[model samples]
Target: MRAAILQSSTGIDPLLSARNMVEAVERAAGEGADMLFTPEMSNLLDRDKARAAGSIVAEADDVVLAATREAAAKAGLWVHIGSLAVKADRGTAPYANRGFVIDDTGDIRARYDKIHLFDVDLPTGESWRESNSYVPGDRVVAVDTPWGRLGLSVCYDLRFPDLYFALSDAGATMLAIPAAFTVPTGRAHWHVLQRARAIESAAFVIAAAQVGHHADGRDTFGHSLVIDPWGDVLLDMGEETGLGYAEIDPAKIDEARGRIPVLAHRRALGAVEVAR
Candidate 1:
Protein backbone atom coordinates (compact mmCIF):
# COMPACT_ATOMS: atom_id res chain seq x y z
CA MET A 1 0.00 0.00 0.00
CA ARG A 2 1.13 3.51 -0.76
CA ALA A 3 0.50 6.30 1.75
CA ALA A 4 1.07 10.02 1.85
CA ILE A 5 2.05 11.79 5.06
CA LEU A 6 1.22 15.48 5.39
CA GLN A 7 3.56 17.64 7.44
CA SER A 8 2.24 21.14 7.93
CA SER A 9 1.89 23.95 10.44
CA THR A 10 -1.64 24.72 11.58
CA GLY A 11 -2.62 28.19 12.63
CA ILE A 12 -5.43 29.33 14.91
CA ASP A 13 -7.99 28.94 12.10
CA PRO A 14 -9.45 25.57 11.18
CA LEU A 15 -10.90 26.77 7.90
CA LEU A 16 -7.54 27.69 6.44
CA SER A 17 -6.00 24.44 7.61
CA ALA A 18 -8.82 22.51 5.98
CA ARG A 19 -8.16 24.24 2.68
CA ASN A 20 -4.48 23.43 2.88
CA MET A 21 -5.23 19.81 3.77
CA VAL A 22 -7.58 19.47 0.80
CA GLU A 23 -4.85 20.64 -1.53
CA ALA A 24 -2.47 18.09 -0.06
CA VAL A 25 -5.10 15.38 -0.46
CA GLU A 26 -5.47 16.29 -4.12
CA ARG A 27 -1.73 16.15 -4.59
CA ALA A 28 -1.50 12.79 -2.87
CA ALA A 29 -4.32 11.42 -4.99
CA GLY A 30 -2.54 12.65 -8.06
CA GLU A 31 0.49 10.74 -6.90
CA GLY A 32 -1.63 7.57 -6.65
CA ALA A 33 -1.59 7.34 -2.89
CA ASP A 34 -4.02 4.91 -1.29
CA MET A 35 -4.14 6.85 2.00
CA LEU A 36 -3.20 10.18 3.52
CA PHE A 37 -2.10 10.83 7.10
CA THR A 38 -2.04 14.20 8.81
CA PRO A 39 -0.64 15.53 12.08
CA GLU A 40 -2.03 16.35 15.54
CA MET A 41 -4.07 19.50 15.98
CA SER A 42 -4.56 19.46 12.24
CA ASN A 43 -7.55 21.72 12.61
CA LEU A 44 -6.14 24.41 14.91
CA LEU A 45 -3.16 25.04 17.19
CA ASP A 46 -3.63 27.72 19.79
CA ARG A 47 -2.23 27.71 23.33
CA ASP A 48 -4.75 30.14 24.74
CA LYS A 49 -7.32 28.16 26.69
CA ALA A 50 -10.22 30.55 26.22
CA ARG A 51 -9.56 31.07 22.53
CA ALA A 52 -9.27 27.35 21.94
CA ALA A 53 -12.36 26.55 23.91
CA GLY A 54 -14.37 29.19 22.08
CA SER A 55 -13.07 28.36 18.61
CA ILE A 56 -13.35 24.59 18.66
CA VAL A 57 -16.64 22.97 17.74
CA ALA A 58 -18.14 19.54 18.04
CA GLU A 59 -17.12 16.92 15.44
CA ALA A 60 -20.43 17.31 13.60
CA ASP A 61 -19.92 21.05 13.35
CA ASP A 62 -16.23 21.09 12.47
CA VAL A 63 -15.54 22.47 9.01
CA VAL A 64 -12.15 20.78 8.77
CA LEU A 65 -13.57 17.34 9.40
CA ALA A 66 -16.37 17.88 6.89
CA ALA A 67 -13.99 19.19 4.26
CA THR A 68 -11.49 16.37 4.76
CA ARG A 69 -14.19 13.72 4.54
CA GLU A 70 -15.35 15.26 1.26
CA ALA A 71 -11.79 15.36 0.01
CA ALA A 72 -11.23 11.74 0.97
CA ALA A 73 -14.36 10.69 -0.89
CA LYS A 74 -13.44 12.73 -3.92
CA ALA A 75 -9.94 11.29 -4.00
CA GLY A 76 -11.12 7.76 -3.21
CA LEU A 77 -8.45 7.32 -0.56
CA TRP A 78 -8.49 6.69 3.17
CA VAL A 79 -7.71 9.78 5.22
CA HIS A 80 -6.33 9.62 8.74
CA ILE A 81 -7.14 13.00 10.19
CA GLY A 82 -4.48 12.96 12.87
CA SER A 83 -6.17 14.83 15.67
CA LEU A 84 -8.57 17.70 16.10
CA ALA A 85 -9.38 19.78 19.16
CA VAL A 86 -13.11 19.29 19.53
CA LYS A 87 -15.67 20.60 21.94
CA ALA A 88 -17.13 17.67 23.81
CA ASP A 89 -20.58 17.16 25.36
CA ARG A 90 -21.54 20.08 27.60
CA GLY A 91 -21.90 18.22 30.87
CA THR A 92 -19.74 15.11 30.55
CA ALA A 93 -16.56 16.66 29.23
CA PRO A 94 -15.12 20.04 28.43
CA TYR A 95 -13.22 19.15 25.24
CA ALA A 96 -11.70 16.21 23.42
CA ASN A 97 -8.55 15.73 21.40
CA ARG A 98 -9.95 13.36 18.82
CA GLY A 99 -8.55 11.41 15.89
CA PHE A 100 -10.65 10.20 12.99
CA VAL A 101 -10.25 7.54 10.33
CA ILE A 102 -12.22 8.46 7.21
CA ASP A 103 -12.67 5.78 4.61
CA ASP A 104 -12.58 6.27 0.87
CA THR A 105 -16.35 6.68 0.82
CA GLY A 106 -16.37 9.66 3.20
CA ASP A 107 -17.53 7.62 6.16
CA ILE A 108 -15.90 7.67 9.55
CA ARG A 109 -14.62 4.16 10.16
CA ALA A 110 -13.00 4.71 13.57
CA ARG A 111 -12.60 7.42 16.17
CA TYR A 112 -9.88 7.53 18.83
CA ASP A 113 -9.72 10.17 21.51
CA LYS A 114 -6.18 10.75 22.73
CA ILE A 115 -5.62 8.95 26.00
CA HIS A 116 -2.47 10.67 27.24
CA LEU A 117 -2.72 14.33 28.14
CA PHE A 118 0.50 16.34 27.89
CA ASP A 119 1.06 17.84 31.29
CA VAL A 120 4.69 18.86 31.50
CA ASP A 121 7.04 21.57 32.62
CA LEU A 122 9.98 21.69 30.24
CA PRO A 123 13.38 23.08 30.99
CA THR A 124 12.90 25.48 28.09
CA GLY A 125 10.29 27.31 30.17
CA GLU A 126 7.51 25.74 28.13
CA SER A 127 4.67 24.19 30.07
CA TRP A 128 1.38 22.59 29.08
CA ARG A 129 -1.56 21.27 31.01
CA GLU A 130 -3.68 19.47 28.42
CA SER A 131 -5.82 17.90 31.16
CA ASN A 132 -7.08 21.33 32.11
CA SER A 133 -9.34 21.56 29.08
CA TYR A 134 -9.42 18.15 27.41
CA VAL A 135 -10.43 14.95 29.10
CA PRO A 136 -8.41 11.76 28.56
CA GLY A 137 -9.77 8.76 26.69
CA ASP A 138 -9.57 5.48 28.54
CA ARG A 139 -9.48 3.10 25.62
CA VAL A 140 -6.90 1.83 23.14
CA VAL A 141 -8.20 1.71 19.58
CA ALA A 142 -7.19 -0.63 16.77
CA VAL A 143 -9.17 -0.77 13.56
CA ASP A 144 -9.15 -2.89 10.43
CA THR A 145 -8.65 -1.34 7.02
CA PRO A 146 -7.82 -2.51 3.51
CA TRP A 147 -4.13 -2.02 4.14
CA GLY A 148 -4.07 -3.86 7.48
CA ARG A 149 -5.04 -3.53 11.12
CA LEU A 150 -4.05 -0.06 12.39
CA GLY A 151 -3.33 1.20 15.88
CA LEU A 152 -4.28 4.78 16.72
CA SER A 153 -2.34 7.11 19.03
CA VAL A 154 -1.67 10.83 19.39
CA CYS A 155 1.17 13.17 20.36
CA TYR A 156 2.15 12.53 23.99
CA ASP A 157 1.09 8.90 23.80
CA LEU A 158 4.45 8.18 22.17
CA ARG A 159 6.05 8.22 25.60
CA PHE A 160 4.01 5.21 26.71
CA PRO A 161 5.19 1.80 25.49
CA ASP A 162 2.45 -0.20 27.14
CA LEU A 163 -0.18 1.32 24.87
CA TYR A 164 1.72 0.29 21.75
CA PHE A 165 2.29 -3.18 23.13
CA ALA A 166 -1.42 -3.54 23.83
CA LEU A 167 -2.27 -2.48 20.30
CA SER A 168 0.26 -4.85 18.80
CA ASP A 169 -1.08 -7.68 20.95
CA ALA A 170 -4.53 -6.80 19.64
CA GLY A 171 -3.39 -7.53 16.07
CA ALA A 172 -2.33 -4.13 14.88
CA THR A 173 0.12 -4.27 11.99
CA MET A 174 0.57 -0.56 11.53
CA LEU A 175 0.80 2.22 14.11
CA ALA A 176 -0.11 5.84 13.60
CA ILE A 177 1.40 8.41 15.97
CA PRO A 178 0.34 11.83 14.74
CA ALA A 179 1.84 14.68 16.70
CA ALA A 180 2.37 18.41 17.12
CA PHE A 181 5.45 18.04 19.31
CA THR A 182 7.33 20.92 20.87
CA VAL A 183 10.72 21.78 19.39
CA PRO A 184 12.75 20.83 22.47
CA THR A 185 11.25 17.39 23.13
CA GLY A 186 10.78 16.60 19.50
CA ARG A 187 14.40 17.28 18.78
CA ALA A 188 15.47 15.17 21.73
CA HIS A 189 13.18 12.13 21.76
CA TRP A 190 11.06 12.07 18.59
CA HIS A 191 13.08 9.86 16.27
CA VAL A 192 14.45 7.55 18.95
CA LEU A 193 11.03 6.90 20.48
CA GLN A 194 9.30 6.37 17.16
CA ARG A 195 11.96 3.94 16.01
CA ALA A 196 11.81 2.16 19.33
CA ARG A 197 8.06 1.69 19.03
CA ALA A 198 8.40 0.28 15.55
CA ILE A 199 11.12 -2.12 16.62
CA GLU A 200 9.31 -3.29 19.74
CA SER A 201 5.90 -3.67 18.10
CA ALA A 202 7.28 -5.12 14.85
CA ALA A 203 4.82 -2.91 12.99
CA PHE A 204 5.10 -0.13 10.51
CA VAL A 205 5.17 3.29 12.22
CA ILE A 206 3.73 6.27 10.36
CA ALA A 207 4.16 9.56 12.20
CA ALA A 208 2.83 12.61 10.43
CA ALA A 209 3.96 15.73 12.26
CA GLN A 210 3.13 19.40 12.59
CA VAL A 211 6.12 21.50 11.68
CA GLY A 212 7.44 25.08 12.02
CA HIS A 213 5.81 27.99 13.85
CA HIS A 214 2.10 28.51 14.31
CA ALA A 215 0.05 31.66 14.50
CA ASP A 216 -0.14 31.21 18.27
CA GLY A 217 3.62 31.77 18.53
CA ARG A 218 4.41 28.12 19.19
CA ASP A 219 7.18 26.25 17.41
CA THR A 220 6.89 22.57 16.51
CA PHE A 221 9.46 20.02 15.37
CA GLY A 222 8.33 18.84 11.99
CA HIS A 223 10.10 15.69 10.86
CA SER A 224 7.26 13.51 9.68
CA LEU A 225 8.63 9.96 9.49
CA VAL A 226 7.61 6.55 8.11
CA ILE A 227 9.47 3.54 9.47
CA ASP A 228 9.32 -0.04 8.31
CA PRO A 229 8.74 -2.95 10.65
CA TRP A 230 12.47 -3.64 10.55
CA GLY A 231 13.17 -0.20 12.08
CA ASP A 232 14.34 1.34 8.83
CA VAL A 233 13.31 4.85 7.94
CA LEU A 234 11.39 4.85 4.71
CA LEU A 235 10.65 8.54 4.33
CA ASP A 236 11.36 11.59 6.45
CA MET A 237 9.91 14.99 5.57
CA GLY A 238 12.28 17.14 7.50
CA GLU A 239 11.07 20.41 8.96
CA GLU A 240 8.99 21.21 5.90
CA THR A 241 5.30 21.75 5.27
CA GLY A 242 4.58 19.24 2.54
CA LEU A 243 3.65 15.65 1.75
CA GLY A 244 5.89 12.60 2.04
CA TYR A 245 5.03 9.30 0.41
CA ALA A 246 6.05 5.75 1.36
CA GLU A 247 5.28 2.22 0.24
CA ILE A 248 4.06 -0.18 2.94
CA ASP A 249 4.39 -3.92 2.66
CA PRO A 250 2.33 -5.82 5.18
CA ALA A 251 4.52 -8.89 4.85
CA LYS A 252 7.30 -6.99 6.57
CA ILE A 253 5.47 -7.36 9.87
CA ASP A 254 5.64 -11.12 9.80
CA GLU A 255 9.25 -11.05 8.64
CA ALA A 256 10.33 -8.75 11.46
CA ARG A 257 8.44 -10.72 14.10
CA GLY A 258 9.86 -13.98 12.83
CA ARG A 259 13.36 -12.61 13.11
CA ILE A 260 12.99 -11.20 16.62
CA PRO A 261 10.04 -13.09 18.10
CA VAL A 262 9.90 -10.69 21.03
CA LEU A 263 6.14 -10.53 21.05
CA ALA A 264 5.86 -14.26 21.59
CA HIS A 265 8.50 -14.42 24.31
CA ARG A 266 6.39 -12.92 27.03
CA ARG A 267 6.58 -13.90 30.69
CA ALA A 268 4.97 -12.61 33.82
CA LEU A 269 7.18 -10.69 36.20
CA GLY A 270 7.49 -11.91 39.79
CA ALA A 271 7.35 -9.70 42.85
CA VAL A 272 10.66 -8.18 44.01
CA GLU A 273 11.59 -7.46 47.61
CA VAL A 274 13.52 -4.39 48.68
CA ALA A 275 17.26 -4.86 49.30
CA ARG A 276 17.11 -2.95 52.56
Candidate 2:
Protein backbone atom coordinates (compact mmCIF):
# COMPACT_ATOMS: atom_id res chain seq x y z
CA MET A 1 0.00 0.00 0.00
CA ARG A 2 1.18 3.52 -0.76
CA ALA A 3 1.33 5.73 2.33
CA ALA A 4 2.05 9.41 2.85
CA ILE A 5 3.40 10.71 6.13
CA LEU A 6 2.89 14.35 7.10
CA GLN A 7 5.49 15.87 9.37
CA SER A 8 4.14 19.23 10.46
CA SER A 9 5.11 22.01 12.83
CA THR A 10 1.71 22.40 14.42
CA GLY A 11 0.93 25.67 16.17
CA ILE A 12 -1.69 27.01 18.57
CA ASP A 13 -3.93 28.04 15.68
CA PRO A 14 -6.46 25.37 14.74
CA LEU A 15 -7.69 27.07 11.58
CA LEU A 16 -4.26 27.28 10.00
CA SER A 17 -3.63 23.70 10.99
CA ALA A 18 -6.88 22.60 9.35
CA ARG A 19 -5.96 24.35 6.14
CA ASN A 20 -2.55 22.72 6.14
CA MET A 21 -4.10 19.28 6.62
CA VAL A 22 -6.52 19.82 3.77
CA GLU A 23 -3.70 20.91 1.48
CA ALA A 24 -1.75 17.84 2.53
CA VAL A 25 -4.66 15.60 1.62
CA GLU A 26 -4.91 17.17 -1.78
CA ARG A 27 -1.18 16.91 -2.40
CA ALA A 28 -1.01 13.30 -1.19
CA ALA A 29 -3.92 12.40 -3.44
CA GLY A 30 -2.33 14.19 -6.38
CA GLU A 31 0.85 12.27 -5.74
CA GLY A 32 -1.06 9.01 -6.17
CA ALA A 33 -0.88 8.03 -2.54
CA ASP A 34 -3.50 5.60 -1.28
CA MET A 35 -3.50 7.06 2.21
CA LEU A 36 -2.28 10.04 4.21
CA PHE A 37 -1.02 10.06 7.81
CA THR A 38 -0.55 13.08 10.07
CA PRO A 39 1.23 13.90 13.30
CA GLU A 40 -0.24 14.23 16.81
CA MET A 41 -2.15 17.35 17.80
CA SER A 42 -2.91 17.94 14.16
CA ASN A 43 -5.33 20.67 15.05
CA LEU A 44 -3.80 22.45 18.02
CA LEU A 45 -0.67 22.01 20.12
CA ASP A 46 -0.30 24.48 22.90
CA ARG A 47 1.41 24.08 26.24
CA ASP A 48 -0.86 26.60 27.91
CA LYS A 49 -4.14 25.21 29.24
CA ALA A 50 -6.19 28.39 29.35
CA ARG A 51 -4.87 29.82 26.12
CA ALA A 52 -5.70 26.58 24.20
CA ALA A 53 -9.34 26.66 25.22
CA GLY A 54 -10.35 28.94 22.40
CA SER A 55 -9.49 26.39 19.68
CA ILE A 56 -10.31 23.14 21.50
CA VAL A 57 -13.83 21.93 20.78
CA ALA A 58 -15.93 18.79 20.76
CA GLU A 59 -15.06 16.22 18.08
CA ALA A 60 -18.47 16.77 16.53
CA ASP A 61 -17.71 20.46 16.33
CA ASP A 62 -14.03 20.35 15.34
CA VAL A 63 -13.29 22.18 12.11
CA VAL A 64 -10.08 20.27 11.47
CA LEU A 65 -11.66 16.81 11.70
CA ALA A 66 -14.59 17.91 9.59
CA ALA A 67 -12.35 19.51 7.00
CA THR A 68 -9.99 16.55 6.85
CA ARG A 69 -12.88 14.10 6.49
CA GLU A 70 -14.36 16.11 3.66
CA ALA A 71 -10.99 16.45 1.98
CA ALA A 72 -10.37 12.70 2.31
CA ALA A 73 -13.72 11.96 0.67
CA LYS A 74 -13.06 14.33 -2.15
CA ALA A 75 -9.58 12.96 -2.74
CA GLY A 76 -10.77 9.36 -2.38
CA LEU A 77 -7.84 8.75 -0.09
CA TRP A 78 -7.88 7.20 3.34
CA VAL A 79 -6.47 9.41 6.11
CA HIS A 80 -5.12 8.70 9.57
CA ILE A 81 -5.42 11.99 11.47
CA GLY A 82 -2.73 11.63 14.11
CA SER A 83 -4.56 13.20 17.02
CA LEU A 84 -6.65 16.21 17.91
CA ALA A 85 -7.45 17.87 21.21
CA VAL A 86 -11.21 17.69 21.72
CA LYS A 87 -13.68 18.49 24.46
CA ALA A 88 -14.46 15.60 26.78
CA ASP A 89 -16.98 15.04 29.56
CA ARG A 90 -16.20 17.76 32.09
CA GLY A 91 -16.85 15.37 34.97
CA THR A 92 -14.00 13.14 33.80
CA ALA A 93 -11.57 15.68 32.37
CA PRO A 94 -11.76 18.90 30.46
CA TYR A 95 -10.50 17.39 27.19
CA ALA A 96 -9.35 14.29 25.35
CA ASN A 97 -6.40 13.64 23.02
CA ARG A 98 -8.13 11.78 20.21
CA GLY A 99 -7.05 10.10 16.95
CA PHE A 100 -9.24 9.21 14.00
CA VAL A 101 -9.32 6.92 10.97
CA ILE A 102 -11.26 8.37 8.08
CA ASP A 103 -12.08 6.16 5.15
CA ASP A 104 -12.07 7.23 1.51
CA THR A 105 -15.81 7.71 1.76
CA GLY A 106 -15.40 10.37 4.47
CA ASP A 107 -16.63 8.05 7.22
CA ILE A 108 -15.00 7.62 10.60
CA ARG A 109 -13.78 4.04 10.81
CA ALA A 110 -12.38 4.17 14.35
CA ARG A 111 -11.55 6.57 17.17
CA TYR A 112 -8.72 6.13 19.67
CA ASP A 113 -8.22 8.45 22.58
CA LYS A 114 -4.62 8.56 23.74
CA ILE A 115 -4.59 6.42 26.87
CA HIS A 116 -1.13 7.22 28.23
CA LEU A 117 -1.07 10.90 29.02
CA PHE A 118 2.38 12.47 29.24
CA ASP A 119 2.87 13.76 32.73
CA VAL A 120 6.51 14.49 33.43
CA ASP A 121 9.07 17.11 34.31
CA LEU A 122 12.04 17.08 31.99
CA PRO A 123 15.54 18.11 32.90
CA THR A 124 15.27 20.90 30.33
CA GLY A 125 13.08 22.84 32.73
CA GLU A 126 9.98 21.81 30.82
CA SER A 127 7.10 20.25 32.67
CA TRP A 128 3.93 18.75 31.25
CA ARG A 129 0.93 17.50 33.14
CA GLU A 130 -1.26 16.03 30.40
CA SER A 131 -3.53 14.35 32.93
CA ASN A 132 -4.27 17.73 34.44
CA SER A 133 -6.06 18.78 31.28
CA TYR A 134 -6.93 15.66 29.28
CA VAL A 135 -8.50 12.53 30.62
CA PRO A 136 -6.87 9.26 29.57
CA GLY A 137 -8.82 6.86 27.38
CA ASP A 138 -9.35 3.22 28.33
CA ARG A 139 -9.89 1.64 24.93
CA VAL A 140 -7.55 -0.02 22.43
CA VAL A 141 -8.58 0.88 18.94
CA ALA A 142 -7.76 -0.79 15.60
CA VAL A 143 -9.51 -0.60 12.28
CA ASP A 144 -9.69 -2.37 8.93
CA THR A 145 -8.52 -0.37 5.94
CA PRO A 146 -7.32 -0.95 2.39
CA TRP A 147 -3.83 -1.37 3.82
CA GLY A 148 -4.84 -4.06 6.40
CA ARG A 149 -5.65 -3.89 10.09
CA LEU A 150 -4.23 -0.60 11.38
CA GLY A 151 -3.66 -0.06 15.08
CA LEU A 152 -4.04 3.46 16.42
CA SER A 153 -1.82 5.21 18.98
CA VAL A 154 -0.57 8.72 19.73
CA CYS A 155 2.85 10.12 20.75
CA TYR A 156 3.57 9.09 24.32
CA ASP A 157 2.02 5.66 23.77
CA LEU A 158 5.13 4.54 21.86
CA ARG A 159 6.97 3.73 25.09
CA PHE A 160 4.51 0.98 26.07
CA PRO A 161 5.01 -2.50 24.60
CA ASP A 162 1.80 -4.05 25.90
CA LEU A 163 -0.30 -1.84 23.69
CA TYR A 164 1.53 -2.89 20.53
CA PHE A 165 1.43 -6.54 21.60
CA ALA A 166 -2.32 -6.40 22.00
CA LEU A 167 -2.68 -4.71 18.66
CA SER A 168 -0.59 -7.33 16.90
CA ASP A 169 -2.49 -10.11 18.61
CA ALA A 170 -5.65 -8.46 17.38
CA GLY A 171 -4.35 -8.99 13.81
CA ALA A 172 -2.99 -5.51 13.20
CA THR A 173 -0.31 -5.48 10.52
CA MET A 174 0.48 -1.78 10.84
CA LEU A 175 0.92 0.57 13.80
CA ALA A 176 0.51 4.32 13.76
CA ILE A 177 2.63 6.18 16.36
CA PRO A 178 2.01 9.84 15.79
CA ALA A 179 3.97 12.14 18.07
CA ALA A 180 5.02 15.66 19.02
CA PHE A 181 8.24 14.88 20.82
CA THR A 182 10.56 17.19 22.70
CA VAL A 183 13.98 17.85 21.20
CA PRO A 184 15.89 16.08 23.94
CA THR A 185 13.86 12.88 23.93
CA GLY A 186 13.56 12.89 20.19
CA ARG A 187 17.29 13.12 19.71
CA ALA A 188 17.88 10.35 22.22
CA HIS A 189 15.18 7.69 21.91
CA TRP A 190 12.92 8.32 18.91
CA HIS A 191 14.55 6.08 16.29
CA VAL A 192 15.43 3.24 18.63
CA LEU A 193 11.99 3.09 20.22
CA GLN A 194 10.21 3.15 16.88
CA ARG A 195 12.44 0.38 15.52
CA ALA A 196 12.04 -1.73 18.64
CA ARG A 197 8.27 -1.50 18.49
CA ALA A 198 8.23 -2.59 14.86
CA ILE A 199 10.73 -5.37 15.44
CA GLU A 200 8.84 -6.94 18.34
CA SER A 201 5.37 -6.66 16.89
CA ALA A 202 6.51 -7.78 13.44
CA ALA A 203 4.41 -5.05 11.95
CA PHE A 204 5.06 -1.92 9.96
CA VAL A 205 5.53 1.19 12.12
CA ILE A 206 4.44 4.51 10.63
CA ALA A 207 5.33 7.62 12.61
CA ALA A 208 4.48 11.13 11.43
CA ALA A 209 5.87 13.75 13.78
CA GLN A 210 5.85 17.45 14.63
CA VAL A 211 9.02 19.16 13.55
CA GLY A 212 11.02 22.26 14.42
CA HIS A 213 9.78 25.29 16.39
CA HIS A 214 6.11 26.04 16.75
CA ALA A 215 4.05 29.07 17.64
CA ASP A 216 3.43 27.50 21.05
CA GLY A 217 6.89 28.39 22.39
CA ARG A 218 8.33 24.88 22.19
CA ASP A 219 10.75 22.91 20.05
CA THR A 220 9.92 19.45 18.64
CA PHE A 221 12.18 16.66 17.55
CA GLY A 222 11.24 16.34 13.89
CA HIS A 223 12.50 13.07 12.45
CA SER A 224 9.32 11.42 11.29
CA LEU A 225 10.05 7.80 10.46
CA VAL A 226 8.59 4.67 8.89
CA ILE A 227 9.97 1.28 9.93
CA ASP A 228 9.40 -2.12 8.45
CA PRO A 229 8.67 -5.25 10.47
CA TRP A 230 12.32 -6.19 10.15
CA GLY A 231 13.29 -2.93 11.88
CA ASP A 232 14.65 -1.27 8.75
CA VAL A 233 13.96 2.41 8.30
CA LEU A 234 12.16 3.09 5.06
CA LEU A 235 11.50 6.80 5.14
CA ASP A 236 12.81 9.32 7.62
CA MET A 237 11.75 12.90 7.05
CA GLY A 238 14.15 14.68 9.28
CA GLU A 239 13.44 18.25 10.42
CA GLU A 240 11.73 19.23 7.22
CA THR A 241 7.95 19.46 7.49
CA GLY A 242 6.05 18.28 4.45
CA LEU A 243 4.65 15.16 2.82
CA GLY A 244 6.87 12.08 2.82
CA TYR A 245 5.89 8.92 0.93
CA ALA A 246 6.64 5.23 1.43
CA GLU A 247 5.49 1.96 -0.10
CA ILE A 248 4.35 -0.88 2.15
CA ASP A 249 4.07 -4.49 1.11
CA PRO A 250 1.80 -6.38 3.53
CA ALA A 251 3.65 -9.66 3.00
CA LYS A 252 6.58 -8.41 5.12
CA ILE A 253 4.65 -8.84 8.35
CA ASP A 254 4.31 -12.56 7.81
CA GLU A 255 7.89 -12.75 6.64
CA ALA A 256 9.24 -11.20 9.84
CA ARG A 257 6.89 -13.19 12.08
CA GLY A 258 7.83 -16.37 10.28
CA ARG A 259 11.50 -15.64 10.90
CA ILE A 260 11.17 -14.99 14.61
CA PRO A 261 7.88 -16.57 15.63
CA VAL A 262 7.94 -14.34 18.72
CA LEU A 263 4.20 -13.85 18.78
CA ALA A 264 3.57 -17.60 18.75
CA HIS A 265 6.02 -18.02 21.62
CA ARG A 266 4.47 -15.27 23.68
CA ARG A 267 3.59 -16.44 27.19
CA ALA A 268 2.04 -14.73 30.17
CA LEU A 269 4.17 -14.59 33.29
CA GLY A 270 2.50 -15.93 36.44
CA ALA A 271 4.61 -14.35 39.15
CA VAL A 272 8.02 -12.87 39.87
CA GLU A 273 10.14 -15.08 42.09
CA VAL A 274 12.34 -13.18 44.53
CA ALA A 275 15.99 -14.01 44.23
CA ARG A 276 18.24 -14.55 47.20
- Which candidate gets the maximum lDDT versus the true structure? 2
* 1-276: candidate 1 lDDT, tens digit per residue: 999999999999888988998998889999999999999989999998778777799899999999999999999989999999998764356889999999999999999999999999999999898888888987799889998999999999999999999999889999999999999999899999999999999999999999998899999999999999989999989988998999999889899999999789855468988898
Model 1: pairs clashing at backbone N, Cα or C within 3 Å: none
Question: What's the true lDDT of residue 51 in model 2?
Answer: 92
RMSD of each: 1.4, 1.0
lDDT of 1 at 109: 96
lDDT of each: 0.93, 0.94
lDDT of 2 by residue, 1-276 (tens): 899999999999888998999999999999999999999999998987789998899999999999999999999999999999999854478899999999999999999999898999999999989998999989999999977999999999999999999999899999999999999999899999999999999999999999999997899998999999999999999999899999999889889999999889988788999999
lDDT of 1 at 42: 92
The C-alpha local distance difference test score for the whole of candidate 1 amounts to 0.93
Looking at model 2, which ten-residue stretch has the lowest summed lDDT?
A: 88-97
Error of 2 at 257 (Å): 1.1
Worst 10 residues of 1 by lDDT: 86-95
Model 2 global lDDT (CA atoms, 0 to 1): 0.94
Which residue pairs show collisions in model 2? none
Off by over 4 Å in 2: none
